[model samples]
Target: MKIAIIGTRGIPNYYGGFEQFAEFFSVYLVEKGHEVYVYNSHNHAYQEKTFHGVRIIHQNDPEHKLGTFGQFIYDFNCIRDSRKRNFDIILQLGYTSNSIWFFLLPKKPISITNMDGLEWKRSKYSAPVRQFLKFAERLAAISSDYLVADSLGIQKSLKKRYGKDSTYIAYGAHPFDNPDISVLDKYELQPENYNMIMARFEPENNLDMVLEGVVKSGDETPILVIGKHETKYGAYLKGKFGQYKHIRFTGGIYNLAELDSLRYYSTLYFHGHSVGGTNPSLLEAMSSQALICAHNNDFNRGILGDNAYYFSNPAEVATLLLTTKKSDNLQLVKNNFEAIKRDFNWEKINGEYLQLFEDCMARHQSGK
Candidate 1:
């Protein structure tokens, strides 16, 4: 099967979740004797024409110069390019900037959109932008040939909102094993002596609330706040929490090995993403055997399933940090690791995507 993966910055995963998904899933598709192409932004670090066996299509992207509006132009370029590719299927990873171009998508290919989290509900966007996102969500739902939800909560939400049935396929992660202890030396950290979070600096991530909880915990243990601290929100968070001696704002670390080692050695891994479905970092932390304290929500709960700690607010976050012990939740960590291997493992997820693609192709061919 010939497939085109759209809606990500591009492969080798220099960015966030969907890029990671494209990097892993597209390689797997190529390995299985299928032709796969991933759309990359012109400015993406990986400038090669292909990654592994998968083809890379670099489209003109001006997001840096134009800001968020640049993404719309990038998506338009990609959609316009896809019209001539004659792909069997185009798997769109998200709809925020791309859904508006649904009318421009080629008619020959079956379009399968991975309906990502509730973007309209994010706190960062203004009322008008949120309303626009909601409308884009509807356009994506109605325009695609099929829909995919990354979590059961998202699937249910899609059904409730648009009466659309979507395939429930959560994100995937590789189980971390044989973590290198020496990696901790670079960060001047010892085993189980610190806590951490690895997520983009966004309001919906609840970073400030989690940090406030950490401050309230009064443990004085150094908590490494990973992710880039150069953004507007990041600077605000730094100004808010920099006075706390234990709160260290380490900029983004993209190395998976370093991140895995960090999580494996941490005392507590706080996942404060309240607005997304099945966050990739949460899965990574679980796979690394980190004792998780996730934001209380259906998405996190559906994935963790009593295998980790839950917190709804700053107070809950403080309580968990103050009282939870790594020794006590060893079994919970083990259970989450097992869950990663059994359910969220990459091979299993890659196969599921393949099956979904095949099924969609069959249904489309049959005119069903």
Candidate 2:
């Protein structure tokens, strides 16, 4: 199958969730003998035309100048190019900045879109922006050949709201059994001595709430917050909590090895994301055996199940920290790790994606 992947900054994924999905998914499909093309921005660090067996198509992305608006132009170009290439299928990773150009997508190729999180529900966007996102969701439901929801929660939401039946396929994570502990020393960290919180600086992530909770927990153990701290929220968090002696803001560590090491070594991992379906970082934390203290929400609960400790307010967070035993945390960590290995395996996810593409193609051919 000749597949063209769209809606991400593209492969070798130095960015976030969808790009990471494109990187692994495209490579796996290529290995299975499917000709895969991933769309990349011209400003991407990796300028190579191909990575692994997957082909990369670069386009002019004016994101630097135009900000989020530039994404529309990028998607327009990608869809325009796809119309010419005659791909068997086009996999759009998300609909945030690209759904407006759905008319440009070729009619011949079956288009499968991953309906990511409930974008309109995010707190970061203004009321008007949220309305736009809601409209974009409607457009995506109408335009795409099929829809994929990463979590069962998202699937149910789609069914309830749009009356659309979306395919349920969660994101994948590589289970790390043996991480380089020496990397921990570089950060002045040790196994089970510190806690970690890694997520983009956003209100939807409950970053402020979680950070305050950590501070209120009053533990002498350091809490390492990892992410880009240049945003307005980031600055707010620093101003609010920077006085805390135990809180260390380790600004945006992108090294995969370092991330895995931190998760593996940390005594507890706080996943504060209250928005989104299946989060890639949360999955990675599970894979790394981090005893999770996730925000109490359907999305986190769907993935973590009984294997994690949940909290809503600072008081709950404080209580959980004060009461939870090390032995219990260890047991939960082991269970969560196994769950990740069993359910969120990359190999299993890639195979499901291939089958989805094949099924869509087959249905398209049969005019069904």
Q: Which number leads on lDDT?
A: 1
Off by more than 4 A, model 2? none
Tens-digit lDDT track for model 2 on 123-193?
99999999999999989988888999999999999889889999999999999988888987887876778
lDDT of 1 by residue, 1-368 (tens): 99999999999887889999999999999999999999999999999998899999999999999999999999999999999999999999999999999999999999999999999999888999999999999999999989999999999999999999999999999999879999989989889999998788998898988998988878788899999889999989999999987899999898898899999999999998988788998999999999999888888999998888888888998998789988888999999999999999999999999999999889888989
lDDT of 1: 0.93
In order, how many clashes per candidate? 0, 1
What lDDT score goes with residue 319 in model 1? 93
* Model 1 residue 275 lDDT score: 87
Quantify all predictions' global Cα lDDT against the true fold: 0.93, 0.89
Q: What is the TM-score of candidate 2?
A: 0.97
